[model samples]
Target: MTNDDLQFAHDRPIAMQQHDLLDRAGFAQRLALAISSWKNQESLVISLTGSWGSGKSSIKNMALEQLAAIQGSQVIEFNPWQWAGQDKLSSAFFEEISRVVQRKNPTEADKQLAKVLRRYEHRLNAGAAVLSGTAKWAPILLGSALVTTALGSVAEGTAAQVTIWTVSAVSWLGSLAPWLKQAAEWCTKRSKNLDQEAKDSELTLSQIRAELQKLLSARQKPLLIVLDDLDRLSAEQLKAMFQLVKAHMDFANVVFLLLFQRDTVEQGLQRAGFDGADYLEKIIQVPFSVPAISSGQLEAVLSGKLDAILANEQQLQQRFDKAYWDQMFQRGMRPFFGNLRHVYRYASTLAFHCRLLRGTEVAEVNAVDLFALECLRVFAPETYADMPRHKALLTNNEPFARQDEPQRARINQVINHLVFLAPSTHKPATRQLLQEMFPTLDWVFKNTEYDRQTQLRWLINSRVCCDDVFDRYFELSVPEQDVPNSLLHELARRIVDSGPFTTLLASHEEDRQAEILQRLFGLVDEFPLELSLAVVQTLLQAGDVVGRRMSFTNWSPRQQVVRLLRLFLLRHDDEAARSQLVIEAFAVGPGLVVVEQLLASEYALRRKADFGCLDDAGLEQLKSAYLCNLRELAERDPEAFLANPDFESYLYDLNRYGEGGDEGRRWSERHITSTTRFLQFAQTLVNTRSRYSGDGVTHIDEISLHSLDELLGKECCADWVARLDTGELSADASQILGLVKEALAHPARSETAEWND
Candidate 1:
């Protein structure tokens, strides 16, 4: 089959008998039998009544097919909706009948009947003209309304107000214009001065009716006229149609199978001061309400069609399961439809949108979620429109500040109203469906509550409920700057060195880069069970650049990468594999910072053994490797090594591990020859306190003598301070010297002050 054929359904009616899915052909069989009987001499008007979209057109077509079996039978169809405006509905009706008669093997009696049908229409118009003059006051009344509006506006209004008032008056007068028009159309059915021709118009209509009945009686078979979509016409059009059947066409061997909603037709009739039910009773000889479809049939047909729309695509099938289908479709989507048209309409929409998302990158929107949202879109359309506008409140899971709690609660109330505000019949079921979509609202509805961990799983599953991807379902495609799941999968598969990874992230705007990194956080959990060193190194390299840009509530992208590494390590089934991956990455990896922080966090978690992975021995191996990598980096490029953002933090961690006291002193003296380099390394070690006094905030740079003595040795610092070129020193350099001189002159304290970073 061609791709276009498979892409979407046209929602056309079931025209042929074989296409009847609801067994509605049984009603068609009964209708055909009535038309064939020809039991009455006077014309028969049978109504095939049902609500709109109840498959009336489809059923009517099936009946017409059944009628085709009868030999010598004639059929004519009138579509009043085509000529809805103007006074041509009645004229068009006769023209259609005459056209059908002349085209359909016209016999002598049929030719006379066709000519008389035209003459009778002219007679009816002539008689209708006599009553038109009685309603001429309607125009005078409308003219008075316009004149009053103009005068009132001129007396108390500006130019804009006068224009608006005139427009309102014209609009109000237009509604009565049709009614007033009937009054101005006058012809004398019983005139004095206009001569016998005016009064003869009424007499001529009677003679034409007599001739029409005589011509129609000679027909061998009934001319069955089917009028579908009668409810689609305006009240005036409806009135004209009823008058044509009741007064003009009560002849022998003619049948009308009128398809309309009973209530709507009655409403149209009521607008013309006729009791609609009573008028229909007078015209229709036999009434057949279209058969009600069983709910089982609707579900079965929709399920079969949904299968066709979804097709056999494996990617879409993976997102759906029997349990989800039961909750979302069988229970959630099923309740909204009341008839066959609703079912077909939903199937058509599903087909079009499902095709749009067919080859999307890495299965962007969940197919089942699309079905759920489509249900809302088709049935509760107002709420569906609100989905994109209220995306934040609907998908929110993060806790808000205490001060903002009331505002959030108010927003939650609005979200809650969506469940309650549905059409009364669907309200309870809508809540059931919405709970499946946004489980975070369970607390408000007294359902089982979901935690952040559940929300995390929703993200990994790429559900419509996930805030990261909620807009995709509405937009029907991945947006610009969006981290499509396909792209992430490709990135993970083709991962290379840190430079490429860093460049890929840096290519986006800063916030978009943060989104890419955050999505990577979940991608870590989704990584294949086999943890590769290339993956680890790429993240380590990429993370080196994921610095400070972030939401305050979220960890910086750099730190997020640290969490990603920890999750990456935890993926291994073997404990030794996890510890070895860290050690291996550090050995070949550029920086020791990621390894130090990861192992340190694991070490902390080990005390509780809740999230910890390594034993004390494996932990010590990672720490030692961190120190080794740090010094190796310094040895290779001291300038770049000293500039590392994590250098001070890693050094403190190294000292805490009980392996950095002497090594830190020797490395600093060798690499830190200049006074500038000395202050850079020493800043973290000194305690800088701020005190507010008469003198604006002064920095008390407390240089502990014992801290220097324990780590770098007091004598070593004093010697470095004494050798400073005092004359060429910068402001910061002079301040560093002053602090060290004062500390070395005093008696050193016993307890050393620690590095505070």
Candidate 2:
């Protein structure tokens, strides 16, 4: 088999049948029993309610399928949403009833109704002659036949129009003809004693009941109507169905199983003319709730699928072990438990990835792999279309916004649950968290990056996690708002422990930590302040490699030691706080080399801040501190530094303190003075005519000095004069001309320094 084929094998979903996949064996049994209980009864109404995708429809389908197989009963599936706003609900009822009845014995109903239709057609063909004599029985026959024949006839084409109209008229008679005939007879008898119009309007409930009883008793098998997708129907439609059931309880030996999403069904039930629970009790004989799969079951299911795939690739089979599955679910998939829709989506993704990897074709993925992939899939949107949108739109007042009171409350609850997943140590941006927590909203705001105003609007609407505060530059609330605090904390824990959010955080820690530490340090590095000491301490104390890369001390001006000591003292012996500061300081140290560069530096060390180069406040503080030190030095050693030969060098360093500003000019100025001094001092050190020059103890070759003269700039010569200070010009001053000739060979400093001057 090609690698692709093997890959496809592993990519098969862990479970294939959604309708039967849920472990609802017990629930299914209960539903079947309920059906059985109502099968022999005259009539039964069942309302199946559960959360969306809670297996209400699945269980209902299962029960009907089983009933059809075991009891030879007729089962019909109805969607009330499709029949909404119909003037006559009775037609819809029969439409569904016709579907089920036709399935049980198509020929019997078809032939019986067809014969009745043939007679009606003949009467119509005979025109007014037949109609005039048949008028008495004709009206009743036509009305009964029209209602009965309309049954399954609606589905047939116009080609069958005559047959359909005939059958409909006949079927109508089959169901209500007897009642109509008896009502007419009774009306005729009663009219003799009373007014005809008055007697015609006087039908009794007993007559209707007797007719319904006769029709129901004639059926051998019960009618099973599966009302699926009630959850999708509007409240009005659901209420109408309830009304129909209540008004016609003794219609037939029928079982109406109404299926709907649990919460939606409950809400619908409440709106459908009865209290939610009370209405449910009246219609639902047995309510079976499908529970979520246990963590153990999830693991088992993944392991089983992985094992099957691993069978082909023994080399990678070892990776699909049980323990592996445990870790994957615990770390990767457990965070998402809202529904099976997500679980199945995650599994399919993992399988496809395993197929993508040609060499390590783990046809089977353990629960761990399943979960890990799930996390990756959640974090990475290109793999699934949903995540990118969540990341994009979740920020704003659009759909994700915390605006709609109900949705806002739900978003708050989700945020509260997310507390354990926030990245406290390396906190992610508000948008990042919201995307993962609320993917739907992210999908909405894909391209609002350039418009800060739009982005802000989203932030206000969603108020997702700390983003609401972060956007407004609000500090985390003190004493912690119970909901947000728990949510942020949990989010931190979850991101660190498992999930795509953590992977993304780890991937971008360097840049993000640098940014946050820079902000936090700038705020408190020099001055003391009370913030979330606990949060800071936790992050700084984690000692993660990423955290160590940040020098919190450089974030502010005070001595690293002093800042910690002050915070410790002011905070009243906060050991956690103290330890955090101490550890960070110890990790970063006093900056002895960096300090010397600040103080006695030879080359000018520019402060990034001086040129507006310090993008964040942290770097700006370092600039502030360096400038402060320079100010202090100028105050204490003004005259010594000015009189000292290196005084100009000191000033030059200060001038070049920022990037590229004034450094070159300062060098030129200082070099001009020093170069002039060296040239005059060089004349005193050696005779112009002599080839040798020396300090008293050491003689230097004259030719060598001439060569050095040509090689070194006037600036270097002046520096040499200060080093080898000798007095008087040489007797052979004219010989200086030759040395000047050599120096003139190179570029002259100015027009005045000529070779033959």
Candidate 3:
């Protein structure tokens, strides 16, 4: 898995061992023809460009070995980056060529030249004698004499051993020149040559020109010198390396073969002040662009690595479970695109991990496992090191601060893509709302700026994102009518299960919580009950406090949320567990049966009037408020409050509100019917007051059958009306008179309205 465990033997192409090269027959044939052309032409340069790990190195290595078999051809298989200047480049390349030609096709001349070089080097080493027994001046004088005799300088004598070492190196080169010239001549003869001089030291540009003339004496055959693996170079270094190749090597017999990444290479070429297209053509007569591997090819590569564990005799056609494997492949393919390097790495790591855990290698891995592992790998320190922005945003910034634009934008991008590779965001309306939530993200880069279609595409291509569900959610945004369906679902579940959200929602009102409840109901078919519980609880809490009190006159996000909850809860069935919720909605203000629904419900006692949990004091506060407000309304125009359609239900529930069992119900019938009659009487008096005073006034006409007896209870009728009228209603003699009218409106002779008229 690492460089230490595996050695890449240059001669043996790994493609042959692993079946990754199977369907690449077309590519192989193209390479073969290209190689044949090179042999016929005598030299050439070919670029094998592809996404990371598309077998460029493997294929190039294989082709080089095959080319090495040619009789007259000699490949200088060296990376120019190994040295810095033109002199070092020329010296290293020509020296390697000299050594290879001598070793591979050693004539008697080459053999004698080699012998001379070795003997001369030995003699030079022996000649450096340390004069131990001589006087100190004698030793210095001896050193000076040797330096002047050989290296030709008095100053050089002080470092006499170093001077002698330089002489030996020169001698070695002198001895090897014959073979070097012969190889250079052969290269020149086979292709368009640069002229060169016959004398070794005189072999400059003029000599190169002469060499070109000699090479041109025959048909012009281009010689290619390929140098791949430039992808491993640093950005600036890669540009410099290519510049060296362009300036020194792009001439007569040679075309330079340079392989690098698309983006980096283009940028490098641009920095070097060369037209990338023209440079590519000049360096590569026929550039072999390796396209991203297909899904099918990737599968073959994965399967080939596990061939030892799987049956080789069985073809991929029928050996595996087609349906299951297809699903796994689809899932696996989701995270990665055409980057074969990452694919191989992912597969290898997964295979190794699988072997470690299961004791057997798996041919195909589960998509989820692959995805998680890939996530871990990408988020690892080494991978994250390559992405500074992602590192800074994810680590240094907090997503919660609304005004922190940079952090907010980063978090939005992260959430939108579910990863940090691209600046992810939704469309107009949804994006606007999101911006409101995290204001600082408003300036994020637009999607159109990148070549990808969706945020998902950018993430996948960048090898940073892979969650399909998360991607799809952001891809589709609906802010007009409601939050997108997926957003709703995600929010509902998230709010429900989150403790903070639960607490926030629990403190709000009922009607305000109903809207979200409706959304919850819609999703109950898919989301589980536990999740629903969390969501419902949140809505109830929010509605209970902030939501119910919210008014359109003072709109805000908190108020809106409460309003939504109200609409939500109104549609759901009243349950004992939701009893406090029911009261909170009614207690917020008034709406009769709606209020009666809570006041008379069994859960009234269950709601402890503390904070979100309504207790007896809270309920009493609501009761007192309602009564106080009602008394004020009645005094102004008693008919107005009593005329409300729900008045009867309100009185009925109030009479039976805290009573338990049938006897309580009987008392409720008696008292509730009487209260209704009293209100009706009050309405009539208000109507008469209006008619007599020639001013408009409201009144109630309906009376119940049990009212007469309650009004005639000796102290009850006059005492109650007089108390109400003299106290809160003292200024409204007309309202008191209306109450008397309502009591008198019932048949005086009747035992009670409950019996008959």
Please write out the lDDT profile of model 3 over residues 420-473, one tens digit for every residue: 332232123222222222212323533212221233222222111322212221
lDDT of 2 by residue, 580-691 (tens): 4433332342222233232332122333323211123423444445545444555575444334333333444455453455532333334434433434323332322312
Candidate numbers, best TM-score first, in rank order: 1, 2, 3
Q: Residue 510 in model 2: shift from native, Å?
A: 24
Per-candidate Cα RMSD to the true structure, in Å, reads 10.1, 20.9, 19.4
Best by lDDT: 1
8-93 in candidate 1: lDDT tens per residue? 45567788889999988888877787787783387888888998788888888887888887653578999888986434777788
The Cα local distance difference test for each model comes to: 0.70, 0.43, 0.41
The weakest ten consecutive residues by lDDT in model 2 span 470-479
Question: What TM-score, computed on C-alpha atoms, does each candidate reach?
Answer: 0.77, 0.38, 0.36
TM-score quality measure for candidate 3: 0.36
**lDDT assessment of candidate 2:** 0.43
TM-score top scorer = 1
